[model samples]
Target: MNCPLQGERKGSVNRIMRELNGISVVVPFLNEEDGIRKFCNTIDKYAEKFDFFLELIFVDDGSTDSSVEILKQCAFQNIKQVKLVKFSKNFGSHAAIRAGLQYASYEISTWLGSDLQEPLELLELSYEKIREGYNAVYIEKKSIKVSKANRIFSRIYSWMMRKYAVESYSSGGISTIVFDAKVRKYLNENMEANSSIMLQAMDAGFKSTVLSMDFHERSAGVSKWTLSKKMKLFIDSFVAFSFAPIRLVSIVGVFIFCIGVVIGISTIVNKLINPNVPVGYSTLASITALGFGITNISLGIIAEYLWRTYDAARKRPVFIVSDVVTIKECESDTQ
Candidate 1:
């Protein structure tokens, strides 16, 4: 069923507009019919309070529902411009966001989630930081009130990202961000498959500011972030940004080789001491199984890197835009 825009504004606007700048917000969603209307309403509400010219770039990530239709029919009072980019098929949120950035018109561009987990006010905060001379602003979630599984995944992913991939990565992980045109241009040119866009942007070495915030739980449609996708993201992030996995494999190989040599010498000495001792097939079998298991895991890690290399060499387009719908409301404010 198609959801209509909320009759009353759902966003809270406590502070008045401090600056006037054209802001482009890229929203990537998949099957978010339940929340897209409210999401749009939130943007409109924010526009009412804050007079900054707003340009919403909503990227439809191949939703099987009426998310796009709802967006097309939705009306806004204060939003300056709206662009809906429809993808050929489901290409994942990261790719969808990249496409949206490519189409972004404003000098300052940022992305928001359809679930509304991040507050709309972060835009103002980020804009302030940008005006203060930062190239980008990362809204780092200090704590996320999600399920146990989600919490665990977030902790592990953030830890690995900080320890291995990007050392400057936030401890709680980053979901919301605002960046200027330089970073936006960089992202538009660097198209990476099966990679984290946020990681790429951060790894590019931009002058950035971090604003700590707490994440709200989902109050609408179910999340499309499946376990398989998360696992793939984990692998992609490491392979694309870090050499730790390859280094770990090499270290494990050396350690295993040394262990094997020590075990072989011990077995030879034991055999010389007791020539009639019964052969310990159980120990031999366990050792063989462990060795094979480790070797297979190492091979799998190497295969991931190889596959990404091949994928990059293929030079496939990161995303395909099947259609685009642009709507302009009155005259947009100049930056």
Candidate 2:
């Protein structure tokens, strides 16, 4: 896992090139059959621009379509190395990426979706930054070509992450990331369910750089990130990394207790001043309902955190690879 340029502090572009070995590109996909071939071809085309070897690790997150079949076919292409890791079931993209990182063989690793929304040139930029001694390089999307509603949701999610999780959370989402083997090891060792890789990397206290790029429309296939999935990811990230929800619950509890105390004191004073003051049943009922609602909400948030803790303690494999298809340089020539 040692970097090709070990112990080299800073060097010119020529020196960096001389010391670089290769990069591992992890592409995690789910039911992206229509775009798999095009994606692989695009990677091969752009890969030739660099002199270093490229290892393509395609993690299939239980794709129901022929995505795996197409990947098997692409394995025979004129690529340096291609490995397909098929999951037993749909464990989600984050899990797929984690699985890919575990199997990545090169010093540097990056991830991209099967849909060609991100330009391949970003990979080159990431590599250059890694060569410049940065442990992690995250791609931030300056703008997206999605619907207005999607845009707003993205913004809100980004804002929440920055405010709650970390100030440096990538607004562009964690779909793409480039980091060296050192950072990769850290991520794998400290993996958590429903967590944000970008946030974790930023919190790793490493020297990192963010490169802003415009997100393009998908070339083929509709996006698989449904609304439910997005919401789940949001909750998972917050529960895993932020204590804001728990703290909010505590604050609400304290505020409610203070309000109750004030109400009680006011009731006693009014009763003493006017013995005929009748107790209002409606007010009592409303207060009771509010208490119940807040209690339930607080319990729910606590339950979420407890469940995540239980999940992490169990230490289940994020993804189970059902199959593998690998194409080596020597094997490709015979085919």
Candidate 3:
């Protein structure tokens, strides 16, 4: 309900900021004005279920709408435990979530969408798995409101991933998941800010499990992610997880080299068969042009691979955070 804000003073929740400890609920959003309330309500439900002080760290990822205002209102009213962190620009979902993770107060932090599509109940399931000794548990999308084309592309992309990029090959039938802070820290510690953590989690060699969950339609507003975005994510998934693209280029170069050797042997046999057959311009010109073109293509691929390595080495900023709200230390004392 439109709670007033006092110029964003570290989230003014009038509710008793309880002394209970453990668990941080991080929800990152971009233009989720209508869904924030319901999302907060879901957080309230989970808060009650857990009996631990729930620190709902909500990131407003450069929303032009009333989303930040809505979060400010919720924080002011203090229905439950929520802290608003507003970013200066839209850095996308992964960046927003990573920002939230950096400021997370509790040792056990989990993230989900602001739409509540990744069910709050998954947190409990994830926690249970963590208790059982898994480092990370990622949400496996069982079913989604995706189109047929998207599904096909996803299948093809995932297949390519298995064949070429990343590691820890596991797919299909997994959704909202949970794990310890160790896993989260591992990801934030050694990942590209713009890269997806899901792939890194797979490659980290951590014992992980994926729990299935019902994918619900967005409760409000439009999905920020589109097909193009998904395709980009698909590429990111491959680059993030596997070096197959680079490896594929390397393998192709080797194959081409072998083929060139065989062609050289064939030319010897051709000369032996007919010494006057190809001491001419036509064959020489064609072979020279073809060989030059293939060599250039192979060199170009190698250059691309080198550029990718340069990108990794630069350590450029993937995300810039404008604000953060985490668990207060008074709460940390209890933990």
- Model 1 sits at a Cα RMSD from the real structure of 7.1
Q: Estimate each model's TM-score.
A: 0.91, 0.89, 0.74
Model 2, 269-323: lDDT tens digits are 9989999989878878988999999999999999999998898889887678898
State the lDDT of candidate 1 residue by residue for 55-148, as single tens digits.
Answer: 7889999999999888888887778668899999999999989999987766889998988899778888888899899999999997776889
For candidate 1, report its TM-score. Answer: 0.91
The local distance difference test score of each candidate is 0.84, 0.80, 0.65
Best TM-score goes to which candidate? 1
Clashes of each: 0, 0, 9
Candidate 2 RMSD to the correct structure: 5.8
For model 3, how does the per-residue alpha-carbon lDDT over 256-322 read when each residue is reduced to its tens digit? 6787688778888988999887565676677678768777876765675566568788987667667
User: How does candidate 2 fare on TM-score?
Assistant: 0.89
